[model samples]
Target: MSVLRIDTSIQGPRSASSALADVAEAEWSAVRPTTTFVRRHLGAEPLPADAWAAAITGGPLPEEQRTPAQRDAIALARTLADEMRHADAAILALPLYNWGVSQHAKTWIDLTIAGAEKGERLLEGKPAIVLTTRGGGYGPGTPREGWDHNTAFLRRIVADVWGAELTLIERELTLARVNPAMEALLETAELMRKAAHEAASHAGRAAASSAR
Candidate 1:
């Protein structure tokens, strides 16, 4: 089986989202030792800024009539889509940026969608897990309830647009230990982080089982 893992944390090894993703991937590897793994580190290699616009406007045009930029854009989109199409499962690690979606993640989604034909959902029914880390709490009843602007947008693209069977693993209060302003919540944050890792492990095993 093949699994595609996409990491969008600019923090690299220090990112909570990526740490959880590592747990998930490790669990999957333990269960399926021979599974093919594909990794895309968007933070380290972001998509070209103009690629999305070019792909959206040029994809429907005949190849012969496409401009060079359009050609390259469409080609890139196709490459990303092909990875998803071939994967038996996927893990996306995304850290909330300023309470919103990461620009790199958004670009990836837009480009992937642009590559698909009309009415096509290339990743339909594919098992996909999303690991998200937020600096603060935003659950209901919290002071910042409804403040999270990323999750809904991600769900729309991952589930509604691509038709992936989605599972979300969220770790909030991620800045508690690092940011002095959140020092009081350090204990809680540690607990949440632990829970998130445990959840990721379970999700990974489930993904492997489903793929098998």
Candidate 2:
């Protein structure tokens, strides 16, 4: 079985979202020892910022008439879309940045859409595990209630657009231990962390079974 894993965390080794993905991938590999993993680390090797626009504008033009940049963008976009289309399962670690999707993740999403056939479900019938982390709490009654703009969009794209069987794992207050202002919430953050990890394990095993 093939699994596609995309990690979009600039925090590297300290990334909370990637940590969750590690748990999920571990469980998946444990269950499916022969699973092939395709990895894309957007933080380390980001897609070209202008690729999406280039692809969209160049798509209608004849190949011979397209500029080099446009051709390359179109090719890269198709590759991104192909990864999802070919994968049996996917694990996406996309953390909240500035209360919304990070630029890297958005670029990837746009390029994939630009490359796909109109209305194509790239991950149709596949199992997708989305691991997202937030530095602050945005739950009900919290100071930043309703401030989360990331999770909903992820759901729409992964589940609705891609037509995947989605499993979402989220961790909030990830910065409680690092941010002095959030010190009091450290206990709650730990609890959320533990829960998210447990959820990741469950999602991973479930995905492995579904893929098989």
Candidate 3:
């Protein structure tokens, strides 16, 4: 089995979402020791800014007619889509940025969709886990309720459009430890973080079992 892990956290090692993804990947590796792992660190090496637009416009054009940049863009999209098509399971680590999806993640999604062949859902029915972290609370009744603008969009693309069997592991109040304004919520933040890790591990185990 193969698992594709896509990391989209600008914070790198300090990123809570990335750490949670590691926990899940560790659990997955525990059960499937020999499973192939493919890592794509988008935060470190984001796709070309113009790749999505080029791909969308050039995909249907004849290769000979496409500009060099367009060709490169199309190729990049195909590579990204191929990773999804070949993976048995996938993990996407995303940190909410300004209550919106990261440009890198969105670019990847757009390119993937543009590259997909007709009637092809590369990740159809595949197990896909999304690890998301937010610096502030956006839960119901919170002052920021309904403030998250990315989760639903992400679901629409990955679950609805790509048809992946989805699971979400979310952690909020992530900035409580560092943000003075959230000092009062530090204890709750710790608890939420711990729970998120546990949930990630559980989901990872479930993914491994399902793979078998």
Best by TM-score: 2
Please report the candidate that would top lDDT against the real structure: 2
Per-candidate Cα RMSD to the true structure, in Å, reads: 1.2, 0.6, 1.0
Tens-place lDDT per residue, model 2, 101-140, is 9999999999999889999999999999999999998999
Model 2: how far residue 7 lies from native, Å: 0.6
Q: Give the TM-scores of the predictions, in the order they appear.
A: 0.96, 0.99, 0.97
- State residue 146's C-alpha deviation in candidate 1, in Å: 1.1
What ranking emerges by lDDT with the best candidate at the front?
Answer: 2, 3, 1
Better of 1 and 3 by TM-score: 3
Predicted candidate 3 versus true structure: per-residue lDDT over 18-135, tens digit per residue: 9999999999999999999899899999988898888888878999999988999999888888988999999999888988999889888888887788768888888899998999
Q: Per-residue lDDT for 1-212 in model 1, tens only?
A: 89999999999779899999999999988999999989999999998989999998897799999999999999999898888888888999988998899999989988887777665776689889999999999988999998899999888888888888898999999989778989989999999988999999999988888773
Instruction: List runs of model 3 lying over 4 Å from the truth.
Output: none
Minimum summed lDDT over a 10-residue window in model 2 is located at 203-212
Candidate 3 lDDT for residue 1: 93
How much lDDT does candidate 2 score? Answer: 0.95
Clashes of 3: 0
Q: Alpha carbon lDDT of residue 140, candidate 1?
A: 86
